[model samples]
Target: MFPSTEEGPEDDSAKHGGRVRTFPHERGNWATHVYLPYDAREEFMDLLDTLLFHAQTYVPRLVRMEAFHLSLSQSVVLRHHWIHPFVQALKDRMASCQRCVPRAPLCLSSPSPPRLPFLS
Candidate 1:
């Protein structure tokens, strides 16, 4: 079955800048995020394939992720006018941090975290 196309009430939180917006849909604005990148190898691909196969049996609509990474920040909405400055700030901050050394796949867990194996 297809999902509904009905629209909901407009969210005014961004205009007020009260709560941090998770998903922003303002026209001409883009969501930006920082992450620790990883190169997925054959073993990791195989594991993901196996997991997706099993998951889809229960949730048929589940789709495999095309890319994966460890997010360092929450999704932040960037207006068209602020994109360059925001990116430059991120670049400056990243340049100050020591290069990251990719570690073996770690099983990260939190009391309420999503159940999944994330590569560090």
Candidate 2:
């Protein structure tokens, strides 16, 4: 039998300075994730600007989001050889899912308190 070449979790943590890997590290493998992109309309931008104006008064370092998206899945590691097949399988799985298009104005309910360094 071939001896296991995979590194233990402790070794991974030591190599990466204790931060958890989104996916296990393996030769020829890459971390992959998927998300649904959000296309903000002009109205949404206006609302965002108004919110930022108010938010900045309390948190001076607050910044606007460069882009917005909703995550569809957690990160998964994929071997280089499996990339094409995995993408094709994902496409097939998504084909039958209903398309989601938001029509109403997005609303924020009970905004969470910001955990700014100054507040802490």
Candidate 3:
């Protein structure tokens, strides 16, 4: 009779809804994210609250964001050596920029469900 092999760690990918990590973990690399801040107004906040309330029927554990913002960049790997220079450059660019209000109107309704294969 053959003996059973040992397992190292329990794989709990479903704990995060089967989401995959974008970047591989390495010692000196850091994941950097850049985003634009969104300050929702009273009417917008009410609408967002209503939407979230409706969505919670399907996703009970969902919660509202204290600070909601649009992501400007995906997770990018930055070596430890480049962290300071990258932050300095970003700061310099942002220093001269005016308040950014999105030019387009917000679409409150989804036209159709997204075609992302993972959801299915």
- lDDT-best of 1 and 2: 2
Best by TM-score: 1
For 47-100, candidate 3 gives per-residue lDDT tens digits of: 989999999999997777678777655567789998898888777777887875
Q: Whole-model Cα lDDT per candidate?
A: 0.66, 0.68, 0.68
55 Cα displacement, candidate 3 (Å): 1.1
Clashes (candidate 1): 0
Per-residue lDDT, model 3, residue 14, is: 70
Clashes of each: 0, 0, 0
Stretches of candidate 1 exceeding 4 Å from the true structure? 1-24, 106-120
TM-scores across all candidates?
A: 0.60, 0.54, 0.58
Q: What is the lDDT of residue 82 in candidate 3?
A: 88
What is candidate 1's lDDT per residue for 8-116, written digit by digit as tens? 4487865643455656576668877667776778998999899999999999866666677886655656689988877676676667677756566565444333221
Give residue 113's error in model 3 in angstroms. Answer: 23
- Model 3: lowest-lDDT 10 consecutive positions: 111-120
Highest-scoring model, lDDT: 3
The ten-residue window of minimal lDDT in model 1 covers 111-120
Comparison by TM-score, 2 against 3, better one: 3
